[model samples]
Every structure is written in C-alpha cells, then in structure tokens.
Target: MHLGQLAQITIYPVKSSAGLNLTQTQIEPRGLRFDRRWMIVAAATGHFLSARETPQLLQLLVQPSEQGLHLQAPGLDLQVATPAPDGQRQVSVWDDELSARLADSETNNRLSDWLGQAVQLVYMAPENQRAIDPRYATAAAQSVSFADGYPILLLSAASLSELNRRLLEKGRGALSMARFRPNLVVDTALAAHAEDAWKRIQIGAAEFAVVKPCVRCVLTTIDPDTLQREPDNEPLKTLIEYRRSPKGVTFGMNLIPLNQAELALGMSVVRLA
Candidate 1:
C-alpha cells in the first residue's frame, strides 16, 4: 500500500469546547499531554460534563499553558495554575469520584455566572485515578482524566468525505471537521475500516499502535456549535445503522504512541503495516 498523510490533528484541552487545531501533534499513551487533562464537574452531583450537556461551557475558552491554563470567559481573564488550588472537592468522571481542586473563587464565579448555574471547575489531579472501561480488556486499567471514554479518538479524512458526499446529496451543509473530536485524523484513501488494518502506524518519527476502535456515544449527537442535542445527525445516525460494534456503533481509531516525543504539525506519516 502507498503512504498516508497526516490529514488533521486536534487537541481539546477541555473536552467539548472549540479544539486547538494543529498541523501535527504527538501521540502518547495517556493522549496528548495537557489534553483533556482537566475538567469541570457538577459540584453537587460530581458528574463530569462538557458543553454538549451544558452549552454554557462554550462561553468559557480554555487554552493550555506550561503554567496551567489561561481561561477567558464573558468578563474574566484568569490563569489557573497546574497544581491548581489545594482545597479538595469531590468530582466524578462518568462514575469515578475523585479528589480535585477548584480553579479559584473569582474564576468559579465567572464560570457559574456564564453557565447560569452553580458549578465548580475540577482539575484532574496527578493523584486522581480513572480507569478505562473494563470491557476493553486491553485498555482497561489504563488511566484517563477529563476524557469522555476512551483515551483517543481517530478519524480519517476519507470517512469525513464520505459523510460529506451524503450530506451534499441531501443538499445539507457540509459538516465541520471538528464534530468528531479526533486526536489524530489520517488521510486514509482506503475504504471504510481501513484504519482497522493498522495495527501499528508511524506519524513523522513517532510510532503508534491501534488500541481499539473508538466507540460512539451521545456526545456525537450533540452539536458542537449550538451545543444543542440533536440525536438525528445523519452520519451519527448512519453510524448506528452500519458500524455498530458490540460495544456500540464505533468510529475512528484509538491509538497509543510507541515513543515519548511530541508530534508537530506538517509532519509526514507512513503506515507501518
């Protein structure tokens, strides 16, 4: 087979917000560093969430930095430290309760006001423990922080094109590439499930192994722009019809890097299979 290009790269420092676009990015076992490493959870219920369930979150812009995170809200500009505040708060990701730090009172107030609800910003602590679903025997016990479910989500440009073709046929607007929220997007000119043939692949000098086929969820049904729930998006609806896995309708690929270096934009990728 011929070589594949690095189609697209994205990082969501905070899940469900506008993602950072990259020409290329590193692939790591825990995912892109500082990516989905922190999250905001309901203080009362301890459940983690994104703008999908709460569109108000889009009002908060999150940018990751070496120091921690630079947050911009309606009227607030705050820098949350990496260690964050020491005060402990109970938080949950899916079903895991974790000890976490509240960003700062001022920041919290701005966020709550924007959200129009009382809520706390929970930073994923180094001490916080989160494990992947046990049903994925190979990925179980693997650590995750603010991520939705699996460690990574991969999409192919070809797949998006396929979806777009159908959309154009129906005279619908072309979908934004961001809707799928993939860490790595490949130019797999091959047919659907082409990535499944990739047990291992190389991006630039970094090597990655496919962990599993990423499972789809309600998150996909949520409009990334309006932040409104639309359970009938065609691609998502079609995914359920044709690609449903025993785990559920699966799309993209989840991968773990074989190296410890960072990947950048414009890097060349070659499939090693």
Candidate 2:
C-alpha cells in the first residue's frame, strides 16, 4: 500500500562536509552513488573527523565533480581529483578500520590549511569492502560507505513537523532537515515517529530493509548555517525528554537497499512487510 512519497534526496560525497541535494539518484550496493565515499581523517591518528567534534566541517561546501570534488570554504576553493589506488592508508571510522586511498598531497595541504589541523582526504576504493555491522546486517556480505552506521537514513516530514510543533510550544525556533543529514525524506500522513515500526519499504524501483532507528548525537545541536552550537540544545534536549531509548535518543531510521535501482522525488513509498 502507498504510505508516502519521496520528498528529498541528499548525498554527502564527503563524510562530515555539507550534503548535496538531488532530485534523483542511483542506489548501489553501498548506497546512493558518491554518498560518503570520501572522508577526512586525522593525519596522525588516521581517525575520521566529523562535525560532532569539528563544527567547522559543516561550513565546508563540497560539490561532486566529473573528476572528483570541488571544495570551497571562506578562503579556500580547490579541485580535488579522485585519489589513485596506489596511495594506501589505514583509516578508522568509529570501530571499523579499513584501507583507503589518500588524495594527493596538494589537496590534503589545502584542506589542512582550511581546518587549521593536519588532516587528509581519503577515498574508499571499490576494493575496500567495509562490511556493515554484522549484528544489524540483514543480508550476508552487505557493505556500506563511510556513513556513521547504515547505508541510508530515512525520516518522515511528519515526524519533523511534530518535532517543530513541540519546539514552537516550548518557545524554540524550528529546524531544517539538514541538521539530521538524512539521505531520504518521505512526506507521509503517518503519525510522528511512525517510521520506527517500519520493517521493509519500497521506493521508486528499489526495495529496502529498515534496519534500525538512528541514534542521534550532539551533532544535531549544531547550526548548519552558522556552524555554532545551539545555546540551549533545544531539539536534542527536548528529544531526550520523550525519545530516549536504551540505545539513545532517536530521530530517524537506517536503511539497507535490497536491490540496485533509481530513486526520484515524488516516487510512491510502499510498506512491504
């Protein structure tokens, strides 16, 4: 049955950097094409950097280019070519350690200057198979990109509207969906937090398994436009009052694609199981 319509598609080509909104995209095994395929890592420790600790990352604008990426910040505008496979480096994304290809030294230097730290841009080459956490994997050998956990994150507009309604009642301003960084947003008549019960769904020509409810973090309290922490942490503080679970306060649902296909805005969403 029709449950909703796809409202938005967003892809973060580089983890932690700004996301690029799209009207349509192809879904691959890992995720939407170019989604979180590139990441910034500490040069010394080889650990991933995210807006949770480095709010400055939210200010970096990244656009996917034919050759690689076009990155821009207040004083920096640079074109980074797709890294060749030869420069191998071990990078850690949370608990997952994998081999990734490092971008050229010039690109690394420019980014480091922009962030005022020693950092390198790394790419997950096709051969670097980072497995999805087995505890949550529905299919054997499922792989994912550099995303925080799952391949795709889905949220309903109705859910955000409900959150905003509560925020307004509390004398707080509304927030945009960008704060949550979801790959998909569905406009539906479902009640607030209804997606938490979804087990399987189909959008456009692709099917997906709703794997888990997304656990929100301090990253949600940062303003994407100003790159500053909210003085009151309104949304998160409010969410914790009502949305807390054993895992943490939750906001969205994580998804794993079941097949290769294309997804577009306005596509009907069907609950399968």
Candidate 3:
C-alpha cells in the first residue's frame, strides 16, 4: 500500500468564517471540536448564510474561547456563548432544515449591525442532528455538524500542485489550498485526484471513509485574503474545462471519521480499504 503523511489540519469553528490551522486536532464524528458548530442564519427566513452570498462573511475572523468562539471584524468583536442556546430555531442549509440553538440577542444584534443586515448567530445543539447523504456513508445512520454535509474534507498536496500547474499554464497565478478549506491535507506520492478512488484511509489511529468529491462552488472563487471574487471568473472557469461533473465541479474529497483520535501533522495516512 502506498503511504502518505497528514501534512496539515484545519477547523472552521464557525461555518463560512475563516479556518484555523492546527498542528494537532481532535477527530470526532461531529468533526473537530467547534468545527462548524456555529453558523450565521438569516433571521427572517431562518435560512443559513454563507460566504457564497455574503463574501464579506469571509472577513469574519474566529478565535476559540472556553465560553465559545470570539468573532472579530474590522472594528467589531463579540464573544459567543459556548453552551447551546435554550431557544431553538429551525435553520435550513442545503436540503436539510436542522434544529439549531439561537445565540443571545446581543451577540446576534452586534453581528447583524456589523454585517449591516438582519441576521442571527445560531449553534447546532448536540441533540439536533443532520444525517450525511446515505448513499456515500458506511454507517446506517451517520450525522454531521453544521458543515455542508460531511464531517471532514480531505485534499492532497499533489492535487493542488496539478491544479496550480494548469492555472499557471493559462497565465493565471497559482491558488492557495485555503480556497478549498480542507480539514486534512495529505502529502502523498499519488497521482492528482487519487483520493477520488480511496474508499477509506487511516490517519493516526483514526479511520476515515473517503465518501464523495466535494462539489466546488462560487465561494471558492472568493480570495480568502481579499474576500473578493476573481474578476475573471478564474479557477472556476478553468475548472469547468476539466473538473465538471453532473453533480458539479469537484475539487476535493469529503471524509467521515469512524472513531475518535488525535491527529497531528506528519502522521501517516495509510489506505485501509
């Protein structure tokens, strides 16, 4: 079996916000602790908002706290409560309408004002569950946090190298992996997009099922540094030339960890199945 090393780990404590890279992380079914546990939702419709629409949401910096995550932007800062809110609100993300705990009004108010919109901060209570799309799952019933669907997203450095190669060939600058915002990055001596065929992989002591190719979206077009979409419709436009699919243009693999374990940088990534 060809072996690889887990080169990096990242967690998005709040959905659509910036991600925090870690040399080590806790692997769990609901995803790394605080990963996408909180999300911003539109108050009027209870529908979740993402950087896909609110590119500015990318500007929100997340700092974890014992109480919860501390959010900062421009000149604003707010400490969100860690405990799930007592009041529940039904929020929709993609095809799922999940039960989410509403944040305190003050936190919501401040964030809404900062974003110049009427929105609310919400948390995914443990009791509330969203199942993964079963066709790709190994378990009869597996759940996820507030992530788009799966518990983890994995990418290989070679894949990025290949994509960058294509982009450079077209006179475009290379893009950063941050555009994909993966949870685990593997440095494997495999061909580009090899993860597309991996049924399962082991990182440290944790086994993860490589479920599906993550469908690319407009949010990827947004530069993490500038929070602005590429004027040329770039990477996405280029991706369509090669990565298009019936489901959508896919750029990375989504994973579901099978057990709890601590993963650290430079850990071996062994293909298990």
lDDT of 3 by residue, 1-273 (tens): 656999988888888988888898788778787789889999999888899889787778898755777888886887888655579989998899988888889998998898889999888877888998888778877889889989999999999999899999989999988998998899999998889999988887988888889998888889989988899887889889888999999989999889999989999988877
Q: Choose 2 or 3, whichever is better by lDDT.
A: 2
In model 3, the worst 10-residue window by lDDT is: 77-86
User: Which stretches of candidate 2 lie above 4 Å from their native place?
Assistant: none
The sequence of per-residue lDDT tens digits that candidate 1 reaches over residues 1-273 is 444677677777875666777755556566777678777766578677676577656555778876788877667677877665567778777666667766777766766776777777777766776776666535445766577766667788877777777767767667777777788777755885688667777776777767788777666666666777764665677667567878788778877656666677656667777
- Cα lDDT, model 2, residue 120: 97
Task: List the pairs of residues colliding in candidate 3.
Answer: none
Error of 2 at 273 (Å): 0.9
Give the candidates in order of lDDT, highest first: 2, 3, 1
| Poorest lDDT segment (10 consecutive residues) of candidate 2 | 58-67
lDDT of 3: 0.87
| TM-score leaderboard ranking | 2, 3, 1
lDDT string, candidate 2, 1-273, tens digits: 789999999999989888889999999999999899999999999999999999888878888864799998888899999888889999999999999999999999999998999999999879998999999999799999999989999999998999999999998889999999999999999898889999999998899999999999989999999988898986899999889999999999999999999999999999998
lDDT of each: 0.70, 0.93, 0.87
TM-scores of all candidate predictions against the true structure = 0.86, 0.98, 0.96
